[model samples]
Target: MRVSPINAACCVLLVALLGAASGAQATSIYRTTDAQGNVVFTDNPERGGEEVELNPLTVVPSGQRAPAPQSRPEASASPSSPSQAVSSPFMPYSTFRIAAPRNEETLQTGEAGNLQVELGIEPALREDHRVRLLVDGAVSQSAMHSDVFMLGNLERGERVLQAELLDASGEVRHRSAPVTLYVQRASVNLPQNPNNPN
Candidate 1:
């Protein structure tokens, strides 16, 4: 069989594209506890481990789309006073005042991060403050009578962090704007100068 140079070049190009696409898949891990109450997880099939996979979401290819409308089921119920609610009604409060780590978009997964909330009370309302570290809508840390929270071992991915402050009456005093945590995956370390242990 005779093969032309152009045909060989096209074949090479296709193979290269396929290889690149396959390598672009993002890898994720699943965590679970073992029988003895010890954490055990793996990614290799030979070792009886399962691998997790995540796919990237895309809207417009090169342009921004309209913002999605929020469905507020709780906010539309009634107008509750901040001092009367049993506990922050799980609704929106005053504007958030973020002060620490100005750039939340630069956080890397498994890295340390911090957040500071400043109350915007015009007359300095007498309320016992509380703070919580929410990762992806889940409370990872919580504290009362505190204004600053530190986050560590953050996972590699996008997460929404918010702070909810309750008044002395257990009412919603203030809520910080949800900050976006854009965590990047760490690079794989390649062995260098192998067999150098002396």
Candidate 2:
């Protein structure tokens, strides 16, 4: 085929333009803070502008091929095959006890008859573990993350309080030694005599 002079020149010009574009590198960006406390980022620099270096762009040549991605091993489809479980960084606590409000002790009722309960766990409590307070063998409080708990308006009688460590799924992992405490409250009563008024 006989090529025209104009078409050959156009083809050469197109090739040059494409080569220049492919070889071009990114310009440095400048960052500056204006007098009004506004952050400005631009390619141009003035008095207070500082040149910022950016990560280089990765370029893959068209002539060279990329490596194939590696495939992961397939898991077993059998129901009897045990799957690998995710391991936690923290281990279970060995000793869990109630630090405050000793067993068989009497506590003076506060203004609203509230009692504070504090727990002590060995190796500290894990992030996924929670504390639950048991009153008379029943769950009185659930999902307490802190070691301190407050019970409001307890009756003036002997009560049993127990602390339990539960996992994220609400499963009991550890139980503290049961603590028996007596709540004391003052009573207001009138004189038995008819004319007892002073």
Candidate 3:
């Protein structure tokens, strides 16, 4: 049977619509590295490359209702009274110790006679806490937050050093083990001339 021109045109339109619909679907893409280490991408499955599956994009039309947001469980309510808040005590400084210039260590002093002090604190120091360096049983340096300190003009003798962690109220919260060290300084004594009169 001879096809009519109108029927032939309808058949062509149907085939075009099917082709367009198929083209809208995502096609598998393959990626591979060549011998020269160059990356190549292709949609041909015969290329012997791993296939990459792409997810279809979803677009929401305007004036349409969107999915409702999920609801999350609320956190437990906080204490309403100050008495409940004070029931727990704050413990700070799990470990504090002097790291540098070990006990009974002898340090050689330079012309300026400067000594460096370092501390080892676990979990680091908090903002509300300050470090104090004790030299010979006194507060030689106080209100320090840094872990390292540079001390100058140390006398030539055995010296004791300690570190204390203080709170905002200047109360000592933790004390490190005392470290003893001797500073060796050059003798300033000059030889007197025998002919010189006293």
| Candidate 2 structure quality by residue, lDDT tens digits, 43-66 | 555555777565454567889877
Candidates ranked by TM-score, best first? 3, 2, 1
**lDDT (C-alpha) at residue 8 in model 1:** 55
Q: Rank the candidates by lDDT, best first.
A: 3, 2, 1
Candidate 1 lDDT tens digits, 65-149:
7678897667566767754443343334333444554536666423433334343332333345555556677877655655555
Model 1 per-residue lDDT at 31: 33
Clashing pairs in 3: none
**What's the TM for model 3?**
0.48
Candidates 2 and 3: which is better by TM-score? 3
Better lDDT candidate (2, 3): 3
Q: How many residue-pair clashes does candidate 2 contain?
A: 0
Look at candidate 2 and give me any clashing residue pairs: none
**Top-scoring candidate (lDDT):** 3
TM-score of 1: 0.39
